[model samples]
Target: MAKDNSFDIVSKVDLQEVVNAVNQAVREIETRFDFKDSKSKISFDGKSEITLVSDDDFKLRNVVDILESKLVKRGVNLKALRYGKIEPAAGNTVRQNVTLVQGIEQDIAKKIVKAVKDSKIKVQATIQGDQIRVSGKNRDDLQNVIKLIKEMDLNIPVEFVNFRTF
Candidate 1:
């Protein structure tokens, strides 16, 4: 049997980077002239969630923008953030929750597999847990699969990992 080349497609976020981004955002808000007297706050909830509170919807949006920019600077994908609706808090403030996505969901994994199958690149893709593994008889075919996947414009961010030729 011919050796197969393979790689795993996974969607993951580094929690430490997220924490750093949140902290940077908080620091900026603290020093920014416009936010001096406002009640804007950003914090991490549990392991993979962020809670943001602000005096109003406008400030909340600004806070989100700051956090997103920081995340981008840290090389974190903005698509990994799943945000909840802005709601009124007890002190007449607005609060929002942003959930960090750490892995690909089953539907997304299936979509990845389907995309690879339809690319006509002579590769077999299978969903393994929260990721998709693509394997082919030629290393070039595997590389083509990666390129094709990048061009598919999927909603989530994907990382190519565990590339093996055997």
Candidate 2:
């Protein structure tokens, strides 16, 4: 009897890394002359949201750019961020909220399953809560599925984990 080989695909972000990135961005903003006196700020809620406030839209954009660079340096995928619309804040500052993506959305998981089925690969792809499990008797087929998924432009960063060959 050939036991199945399997792997799980999930989209996740490390909140600690996000906090570090936000802290780095804040430090940089404080040192930069353009933002020295300009009310530019980045605040993280220690969970899934980061808020940016600046003197105006231009400064706000600069703050976002800095924060993005810091995040990238921390190996955090830019796709994990969902930018909110800029709006007025207290004291006439422009504020924007950036939501950190934490899991594979249902629609995206369905899309992944559909893609796997359309490929006609001899593997089973199933949505398991906020992740997807792919299993097959042949390990090569599993590898092929991984390659196929890597080729997909899913607009979110995915990681493969819990690979098991039984």
Candidate 3:
């Protein structure tokens, strides 16, 4: 029996790395001269959300830019940061919530499958829960599929895992 070469595509972010980045951003925010008396603050809930509070719109933008740079330095994709509505908080402050993307959604998985199919590549793409599995007889075809998917501009970060040939 000829076995297939297969690999899995998954969207996963290292929360620990994000936490470290958040910590770094907080430190920078606290010590920066511009923020010395601006009452700027950044907080992470240790899960999948972050909150940014600043005295006004200008400081808020600065804080967001700082956090984004830290996240990119930590290897987190900038697209993974989804910003919520910037609303006014109590005591003359502006607040914004940032949501961290964690996994591949079903819609994205479907899109991957569609792209693979559309490319006329000789591979099978299956949506296995939160991940997509691609398998084919030709390893080269599988490699091509990976390349094609990477070229697509999906809104989340994806990782290729469990590459196996049997």
RMSD (Cα, Å) for all candidates, in order, is 1.2, 0.8, 1.1
Between prediction 1 and prediction 2, the one with superior lDDT is: 2
Q: Which residue pairs of candidate 1 clash?
A: none
What are the per-residue Cα lDDT tens digits for candidate 1 across 24-141? Answer: 9999999999999999999996588899999999999999999999999999999888999999997899999998887789987877788877778898998888888888999989
Model 3 vs. true fold: TM:
0.96
Q: What is the C-alpha lDDT of each candidate?
A: 0.89, 0.94, 0.92
Ranking by TM-score: 2, 3, 1
Q: Model 2: how far is 50 from its true place, Å?
A: 0.4
Better of 1 and 2 by TM-score: 2
Residue 136 in model 2: lDDT: 94
lDDT (10s digit) by residue, model 3, range 1-65 = 87899999998888888999999999998888989888789999998999999999989999999
What's the TM-score of every candidate structure? 0.95, 0.98, 0.96
Which wins on lDDT, candidate 2 or candidate 3?
2
* Candidate 3 residue 1 C-alpha distance from true site, Å: 4.9
